[model samples]
Target chain A: MGDNMSELLNVKNLKTYFFTKYGTVKAVDGVSFKVDKGETFGIVGESGCGKSITALSIMRLVPDPPGRIVGGEIVLEGEDILKISDNEMRKVRGKKISMILQDPMTSLNPVFTIGIQLEEAIKIHQGLKGRSLRERAIELLEMVQISSAAVRYKNWPHQLSGGMRQRVIGAISVSSEPRLLIADEPTTALDATIQVQFLRLLRELQEKTGVGLVFITHDFGIIARMCQRAAVMYAGRIVETGSVRDLFDNPSHPYTAALMRSLPKLEEKVERLASIEGQPPPLNDDIQGCRFAERCTVAEHQCRLSYPDETEISDGHFVSCWKF
Target chain B: MQRYIVIRFIQTVITLLILSIVIFTLVRMSGDPVLLMLPETATEEDYELMKSQLGLNKPVYQQYLIFLFDAVKGDFGKSIRTRKPVILSIKETLPNSIKLVTVAFVIGFALSIPLGIVAAVKKGTVWDNMARVVTGLGQSIPTFWVGLMLLQIFVVWLRILPASGMDTWQHYVMPATCLGIFLMSGVARLLRSSMLDVLDSEFVKMARIKGVRESVVIWKHALRNSLLSVVSFGGMYIAIMVTGAILVETVFAWPGFGRLAYAAIVNQDFPLIQGVVLTAGAVVMSANFFTDILYAYLDPRIRVQV
Candidate 1:
C-alpha cells in the first residue's frame, strides 16, 4: 500500500468534446493534470470553463453520442485508461477510481434508502454479501460522520438534508477505498457552513486513507483552502498550474492575476476588483489565437493571431500566455 | 395521515351524493316513466298503475331519498328489463371483467417495461428499433382485429388454444391479447419516455461515479425513479382498460360487465344502463383515488403539505 501511494494516478493531454448538432464543443480542449499519490489536486474555474469536463474525462464517464473524449491519454497508475475495454473500464471504475458528482440533491437516488444504495456499490465491486456487506455499508456511513449511521441508513435521500445527502454520497464514493477519487463541485449546491464541513470531511478522509484526490470547482477559495496544488482553467484550457502558495502569491499570467484580484479583500479600499471582461467564447467556434484574447486586457496582435504554449513560470508554476 | 385520509373520504362521499342525485333527477326528467313502460296500448289507469308501481306517485324529493336509501343499502332496485336486482346483475358480470382487465394489465406491464428499459439502454440500436416496430405494430392494428387474427392463427390454424369464450385460463389468451396489445404499446411508450428522463438525471451519473454496475445502473437507479410516470399513468390505463374491455369482451363473447353493458346499451334498458354505468364510474373513481394516495406516499413533500 505504501509503494502504491508513492505513485497512484497520472493523466496526459486529455481532450473531452461535445458533438452537438451545431458543432463540436471543445469543452475540455487539450486539458491535462495529475493527481499524485495522497494529494488533493484542485481545478478551479467559472461555470462552463471545462473544470467538470476534465473530471468526467478522467473517469471516462461522459455520456456519449453527444459528448466524448475525442483524443489524448488518461494514464491511471501505469495503464492508459482510454485504451482499456468497456468491461475493463467498469472493473477499474468504483474499484480503483471512484467519483462523486456535484449537486447533492440530484446525485443520490431519491426513491432508495441510503443503506440500499450504499450496499449496491459495495456488493457490485466487492461481491460481499449478507452480513458482511451490511456491516461494511454501516462502516462507510460511520466514516462520513453521519449521526446514528445505523438508523440513518434506512432513511431515503429525501429524508436527509442536503448536507447529510452529500455526506451519504461521500460514503458511497469512498466505500470501495479506491486509489483515486474525483469530486466535481461537491459543495457548490450546499450552504456555506455545510460546504465548509463537507470540504473538511473530504480532506480528513483523504488524509486517513491516503487516496489521491482530484477536486473540481469554480470557487478559488475552496481550492486555496483544500488543495496543496491548484490548476486554474479558462475557456477549457489550464491558464495556470502550481502549488496554492505559488499560484496565489506570485501569480504570473494576466488571467491568473485577474482571478486573484477578483477575490474580496477587507484591507483595501478598491478602485476596481479585476474582472474578466467578456463572456467565454462560443464552444462551437474554431480556435485561432488565444481563446481568451477577446477578453484579455493586455492581449497583443500576436496573442490574437495564435494560441500560446504553456510557459514554465518557476520550478513549481506553469501559465499559458505570451506575457508569461 | 389519518386526518388527510378522513378529509379525502369526506370529499368522496360528497361527490358520490351529488352524483346519485344528479343521476336520479336526469333519469326522471328525460322521459315519462309511465309512457316509457306502458307502450301505446295502455289506458289512463294502466299508466297510473305503472307510475304507482314505480313509486312515481311520491314527491320528487321523496323519491330521491328512497332511491338513495336503497342504493346505499346495496339494493339498486330490479331492472325493469331483466327483472333482476341491479346490484346482483352488475356483480354477476364484474368479476370476469376484473380478471380480464387485471390479467391484461399485468401481462402488458410485464412484457413492455423491461423491453422499454432495454430499448432506452441500448437506444438507437437493434433492440430500440425492434421495440419501436413492435409497439408501432401493436398500436396500428385494431384490438378486435388482433383478437380475430390470434383466433385464426392459434385456434383455427394450429388448433392449439380454444376459439373463444371465457371457460378456462387457456381461453384468456385471445381476449387478453386483444386488450394487452394496446396496453403493451402504451406501457412501452410510457416506460421509454420516463426511463429516458431518469437516465438523463444527474443521479444516474452520480451512481456511475459511485462505481455501480451497468445492469444495476438501469434497474436500481434509473428505473426506480422513472416509476412515477408509469405508476401515475397506471390510473388512466386501468380506467381505460375497464372501459375498453367492453368491446374486447363482447367480441370474444366473454361474460363480463363489458358484454353486459353492450347488451344493456343495445336494448336501452334504463335499469341495466344505470347499474353498468355506475359500476364503471365506481371503478374509474376508485382507481383515481388509489393513484392519488400512491402519489402522496411516493412523494413526502406532497404529504407534508397535506
Candidate 2:
C-alpha cells in the first residue's frame, strides 16, 4: 500500500452468478480492472448494465445460495483474495479497502448513532479505545466538514440530514485511511449541490490520504466530474476504457456514443436529447454478438453474429466494437 | 419517537378495555359458583342469596366497573374455591408461573436466534431445510401435545426428569420444553426471513467490504438490525405465554392461579374468576405497552416512519 510500482488493487476474469429457479444469471462475467494509488477510477453504464455488480464482485459481497462468485481472481496487493478463507477475508475487509454503499439512507444501521457506527468501524480497524475512540470519531466527522462535529456526532442517523449522513459515511470510510475506497454510487441519492460538494470532498480526501477510489455510477456527469479514467459497461462486459476526456470527446463504441449523446448538454440548446432505443437484454440471453447490436447505430452483419473483441485504439484507450 | 409511544399506548389501552369487557361478561355468564359449590339440598334461594352477596345479581356492566375499580386499589376479590384472598393466591403461585415462563423464554430465545441465523445464512443447505421443517412441525402441533410427548420420552420412559410440578429444576424440563417449543419455532422462522433481509442490506455489505470481523458485522450491524423483528415477536410472545401459562400451570397441578382460576370458572366463582381474568388483562396490556416503548427505543425509523 505504501509502495508505488505495486498495484493497489487488481481484479482479473471475475465471474459471479445467481443460481435462481429460472437459470444462472451471469450478473458479472469476465470483468477485469485495476485501481492505482490516489486516483479516481469510474465504472459507468445504464441500469442493470453490470456496473454495480462488478463492484459487488470486487468486494465479494454477493449473497450466497442464489448468488456465488463462481470463478475469478481478486488480487489485492500481491495476494489472491478469492483463495483466502472467509475469516481472513473479513479481517482484511475494513483495514485494507472500505466500501461506501449506494444509498446512505439504508446503509447505516437504524438503531445506532452515526458516531457509534463510525467508531465501531474505527475500533475494529484501528483498535482505538474509550475516550480516544470518541475523539477519533469526532476528528473523522470534522474531516468530512460536518458542522458541530462534537454535538451532531452523537446524533443518530435519522437525526442528521441526508447529505450529512453521506458525509458521516465518508468519514467512516476514511477513518482507517485504507489505500483503496470502493464508493458505489456515492452521490446518487444526494441533490446536485450536495453531490458536487460530496464529489469535491471525496477528491480532496483521496488526494490528502492517497487512497485509490473506485467510483461506480450510471451518471456520466458524475464520471466527468470525479474520475480521471472511465470504463464503459454494456450488458455484463466492459466495452470501452480510457481517460474520461477521451471517452467523452470521442466515444468509439456505438453504445458509449449513444450514452454521451443521450445526456443533455448544458452548453447547447438542442431540439431534443438523443435517446438509446430498446430495453436491456434479458438476464438469460447468451449474448453471442455485441449486447448493444440491437440498438447500435451501425450494426453490421458480423456485429449480430459474433461478439467483437476489444481492440486497443490508442495508448490506453480500448473499445470492443470492430470499427476503425 | 414520542408520537409513536403515544399512539402505541392508546392502542394498547383500547385493546385492554375490549379484552376486559369480553372476559368479565363471559366469566359471569358461565353461571353461579355456589351452584357447583353447594349440594342438591341448597334451594334456588341459596343461589340467589350468594349471587346477591357477590354482586353477581347486578348487571354485567356494573360487575365489570367494580372489578376494574378494585383492581387499581390492589384489592382483588377473595377466591370462592379456596376462600382465600385473591391477591394472596396469586402472590403464592405467580412466582412459579414467572420462573417457568422466564426459563422458557430464555431457552426459546437462545435456540431460535441461532436456528434462524443458520437457516437464513445457509438458505437451501441441509441445516436450513431441517430448521424449516422443524419450525413447520412446531407451528402445526399444539404445545400441550408437544409437552405430553416430551414427558413420555424424558420422564415416562427414561425417568430422567419429573413430569410435573414446579418443585425442582428437573420438574421444569417438561413444562419449559412444552412452552418453548412453539415459540422457538415461530421465532426461528421469523428470524430466518429477517436475517436474510438484514444480510442483504447495504450496511451488511459495507461491513463485509470493510474487512470487519464476521462476529462484529453480525452483532453490530446485521444481528441488531435482524433483532428488530424479534422485538415485535417478543411483545406478542409475552402476551401468549401469559395466557398459555394458565393451561400449563393447571396441567402440571402446580397450585398456581391457572388451576385455581380454572376451577373457579368451572364452579362459576365470581370473585376469584374476576380477579384472575382482570390481572391477566393487566399483565398482557403492560407487556404490550412496554414492548411499544422498546420498539421506539430500538429504532428511530419507527418514529420517523410514523
Candidate 3:
C-alpha cells in the first residue's frame, strides 16, 4: 500500500478545540496521519468521535467563535499550510487541497444554479471565463457522470435529486484538480444504491486524477471497500492505524475488536448483534486515562490510570493500548 | 412563468373585489353621508330629495351593484364633500404620496439591508450592539411622535428644513425620515436574524471551503438569501406607507393619499372614502403580487413550487 508514492499531506499532533459556555471541547486531540499521492486513507469513528472535525481542521475551516485549531502542523506538498498567510491559504484551498463536505443536500447553495457554482470555483482558481468557463463547467458535470450535463448546468440545487446533487458537489470540488481531496461522510445522506455508485465514481476519479483522498466515515465497511490504509478513531484520538488488510485480519485495539464484533456477519448467525457497553467520555471535561477504558472489557488497572503510547505491532500496523 | 403571472393577476382581481365589498359595507355602516351633507334647517321633504338624488333610496345590494359597475368603468362617482369626481381627487393626491413613499421606501431598505448585513457579520461585536440600539429605538417609537420630534429638532429647533407641505424635496425630509425610520428598524432586525441563519447554513461553509473570498461570501451569497425575508417585509411596508401613513402625513401636512383618506373619513364622503380604500387595496394587492414574483426569482425552490 505504501510502495514508493510521494507524500501528499502530512498532519502531525493536530488539536482542534471548541470553547463553549459549558467548557472547552477537545474535538481533535493530538491526532496525526499522512496521505501519499493517489492513496485512499480512511478515518473511521462513531458520531462525535471527531472524524468530521479532523477533516474541517485540514481545510482550516473550523467555525471560530468557539472552534479553533489550537495546535497542528498540516503540511501539504512540502508546504506548512498552518504557517501561511490567509491570502496564501485561500489560494491553497480549491487550487491545492479541496474538500467535499457531508450532507450534499445542504452542501450546494440553494439560490445558485449548478453551472454558476461550478463556474465560480473555476473562475476563482483557474481564472477561466466566457465560453471556456461554461464549457469547463459542463465538462465537469459530464465527468461526474451526470446525465444531460448541458441541461443540468442551469438547474438549481433543489431541482437535482440527492444523488445528483452529491455528484455535482463532487464535480465542483475537483474542478481545479486539487492534489488532495477530503470527503467527510459524503454518502451519509444518500440511498444505499446511490452510495455504492458514488463510491465507485470517487474511486474512478481518484484513479484517473491520481489525487490523494482522505475518506471520513463511521462505517468500517466503507473503509475496507475504499481505503488502502485505515485509522480507527476512538474518543477524539486514533486508537489504531494500519493497512486495511492488516487491521481487518488482526484487530489489535479492544475498541476496534468491539466494533468488528458489533457488525453483523453473513456466515455467523446470532440472536442479537454484539454491542459495546457505556459511552465515550464527555469531551468538555478533562479525561484522565484512556477515553475507552470504562467501556473496554479487557481494561487493565494501568489503562484506567493513563493513556498508552503507540506500539508498532507490524511493518505498518500500530495500536495504542496497554495490551499491545 | 406566464401562467404564474396570469394566476397571480386573477387572484389580485378576486382580492380587490372582496376588498371593495368590505369597504362598501363598512363605509355605509359609518353613518349616512347625506345627513352630513344637509343642514339642520332642511325640511324632511328635502332630506328625501337628497336621499333619492344620491341613490340612497335603492336597496343596499342594488347600490353595491351600481357602485361595482361604475368602479369597473373607472368611474368612482363624485365626492359628497367636494362635489368633484372621486377619481380626480385620487389623481391629484396620489403623485404626492408616491413621491413621499418612494423616498421613504428607498431610505428604509437602503439603510436597513446594509445595517442588517453588518449586524449579522459583526454579531456580538460593538457594531451589532449599536445596530440593535438603533433598531430598538426605531421600532419602539410611535410614528406620530417620531414625526413631531423630527419637526421639533430639524424643522422647529434647527430650522434647516421646511416644517410642512410638499413644495420642495426639503419639505419631504422630516416626514420621509419619520416614516422610513420605523420600516428601516423593523427590516434591519428581520434581515439581521435572517442573515445570521444564512451565515450559519452548510452552503455558506461550503462556499468558504471553495476558497471564495470573504466579501463575496457575505455580500453575494449570504446577502441574496437573507434578502428573501426583507423583500416580503418591504413589499407589505410599501402598501402600509401608501395607505397607512396618515399619522406622518397629518403631522407633516403633506397632501398625500393617506391625508385624502383621512379627510374623506372625517367628512363621511362616501364616494371619496370608497375610492381611497379601493385604491389602497389595489396597491396592497399589487405589491404582494410583485413580492411573490420576486420570491420566485430569488429562490428557485419557490419557483418550482409555483
Candidate 4:
C-alpha cells in the first residue's frame, strides 16, 4: 500500500449492488484500493466485472432505483465522502474529484459548444465568469493541445473528431485541478493511433498537475504503460493487487495468470490465442465459495466451500486465492 | 442556413398548391353551390343565371384554372351565402381562432413540460403514476364530451364561468382547457419518454459527474434535449388546433375559423370551403417548416447537415 501521508483516495470494502425486479445484483462486492498523489492506479477487468461500477461508486454516481452503494467508505484526503450531505458531495465531485467517461461521442452534450461545456465546469468549480472565464477556458483548450483554440471553442461536439472531443473531455475533467480524476475507459472508442496519443496526453497532464488518477480499462497494454500500481478484478472482487511490474512478472491469482496468458505475445508464434473458458457466474445468485472457483484450474474442494482471504506474498503484492 | 430556409419555403408553396387542387375538386363535388344560392320558389332561370354569374357554368378544369389564377392574386372569390369575399370572412374569424389556439398552446406547454420532467425524473414514484393517469385520461377522453362536461360543471353547477360565446375571458377558460388538455397530454407523454432516454444518456451522467446541482441537471441539461420531441409535436398540434377545433367551437359557440368552416361546409359554400381548407393547409405546412428550423437550432447535428 502507498504511504498514508501521500494517499489521495482510499476505498475500503465498497459493495455496490443493483436491486432489479428479479433479484439483487452484487455488481461490486467488497472491493478495496488506494491511490496516491501523482500515481496511477489501474483497474483491469473484462466487461461486467465491476471495474466501472467501482469508479462510479467513488463518484457516488451509481444510477439509483436499481443500483446503490450499500456499503462503502470512500476516504478522500482524510475525509469520508459517503457521510457528507448531497450538497457537499456535489461540491466534492467537480472541484475535488472529477471523472472522464468513455465514448467522447456521447459524453458531451450535443446542443452545447465545446467551449461552453468546458467553461461550465470552470464556472462551477473556479467561480470565474465573463471575459476571464472565456480566456481561462481557451487556455485549458490550448493546454490540452487543441490548436486554433479560440475558433475550436465555438465548434459543437459533433463538429470535432473523436480524438479532439476526448481531449476536450480530458480538459474538462482536469480544469479544476482536482485531487483525483477517475477515467472510465476514456479511450475505448478512439482509433488505435488516437488512443496512443490520448494516453500520452493523460500522462503529461498527470505529471504537470500531479493529480492522482484511478485509470479503469480492460486492456492490459494500457495498464502496463500507464499504471504504477494495478488491481486485477473478477466477479466484483479484487483478485490481485501489486506494482505493475510485479503483476506482469508474477501473477498470483489464477484468474490473473489466465488473463496474462490470454494476451497475445509478440515473441511467441502461435496459431490460436489462449482464452478463458466459461462465463462469469450470474451476480444475482448468492455464492458461498470463491466466485472464480468454477473457472479456476487447480481449484480444490476447499476453494468451493469458502472464499479465500488475501495473503501478502511480497512487500506490496497481495492475492486472494486458496493456493495463496 | 439561408439555403435551407429557401428550400423549406419552396416546399411549403408546393404543398399549398397540391392542397388547393384537392380542396377545389372536393368542394365542387359536394352538390352545386348554385342550387344553395337560389331560393326554393326560384325557377330554373334563376339557378342558370346564378351558375353563369358565379362561373360554375364553365368546365371543371377551366373553373380550376380561373380559381387558381385568382387565388395566386390572393382572391378566393365571394361566399355563396353571405356575398362577402371568402378571404375577408377568413380575415375576420382567423384572429379569434388564433387567440384561442395561442391560449391553449401556452397553457398546455406550461403544464406539460414540468409534468413530464417531474414524471420522468421521479420515475416509478407517485408523481410518475399520477402524471401517467392524468395524461392518459386527457388523451383517451373525447374532446367534445370534455367540453360539455366542463360547461356543465363550471357554468351550470359552479356558476363561475360563462357557458358560451367569446364575450368575456371567462368564456375562454373552459374551451381553452378542453382544447389544451389533449395537447398537454400528448406533449407530456412525448416529453416524458424523451426525458427518460436523455436522463440515461452519457451527457446527463457526465453533467452529474461535474457536480452540477441536481436542479440544473434536470432543468438545463435534460430538459433542453427532451423538449425536441415536444416542440415538433406541439407545432403540428397548433396547426390542428387552428383548423380542427370545429367541435369545440360549436360546443362553446366561439366564432372562430373552425366554426366558419363548419358553417360553410353545411351551406355548401364552395368558395368559402376552398378558402378555409386552403388556409388550413397553408397553416399546417408553415408550422412544419418553422418546426424544422427550430429543430435544427436545438440540435447541432441537424444544423451541420443542413
Highest DockQ: give the candidate number: 4
**Per-residue lDDT for A106-173 in model 4, tens only?**
99999999999999999998899999999999999999999999999999999899999999999999
Off by over 4 Å in 2: A1-7, A267-271, B1-65, B79-82, B300-306
TM-score of 2: 0.90
Q: Which residue runs does candidate 3 get wrong by more than 4 Å?
A: A1-5, B41-44
Query: Alpha-carbon error at A206 in model 2, in Å?
Result: 1.5
- Per-residue CA lDDT of model 1 for B1-306, tens digit only, reads 666666666776776777787778777777775687677987998988878888999998999898888877877777778688888878889999999988898788889888889888888899999999999898888887887788789988999998767888998888888898899998898889889989988889877766667888898778867777777786688777876788788778898999988988887677777667766766776776677677667654445455
lDDT of 4 by residue, B158-222 (tens): 99998888888887898899888988998999999999999999999999888889999999899
TM-score chain B for all models: 0.91, 0.84, 0.94, 0.92
lDDT of model number 2: 0.81
Minimum summed lDDT over a 10-residue window in model 4 chain B is located at B235-244
Q: Give candidate 1's iRMS in Å, 1 decimal.
A: 1.9
TM-score of chain A of each: 0.96, 0.95, 0.97, 0.99
- Which DockQ-derived CAPRI band holds candidate 3? high
What's the distance in Å from true for residue B78, model 2?
3.8
Taking the tens digit of each residue's C-alpha lDDT, what string does model 1 give over A37-130?
A: 8989989888999988888888888889789998898878889999999888888888789888888898877777899889988987889999
Can you give the DockQ of every candidate in the order shown?
0.59, 0.62, 0.81, 0.82
The interface root-mean-square deviations, each candidate in sequence, come to 1.9, 1.6, 0.7, 0.7
lDDT per residue as tens, model 3, A160-183: 999999999999899999899999
lDDT of 2 by residue, B48-101 (tens): 888788787888778779877787687877766677888887777767777888
| lDDT for model 1 | 0.84
Model 4 stretches with alpha carbons more than 4 Å out:
B29-62
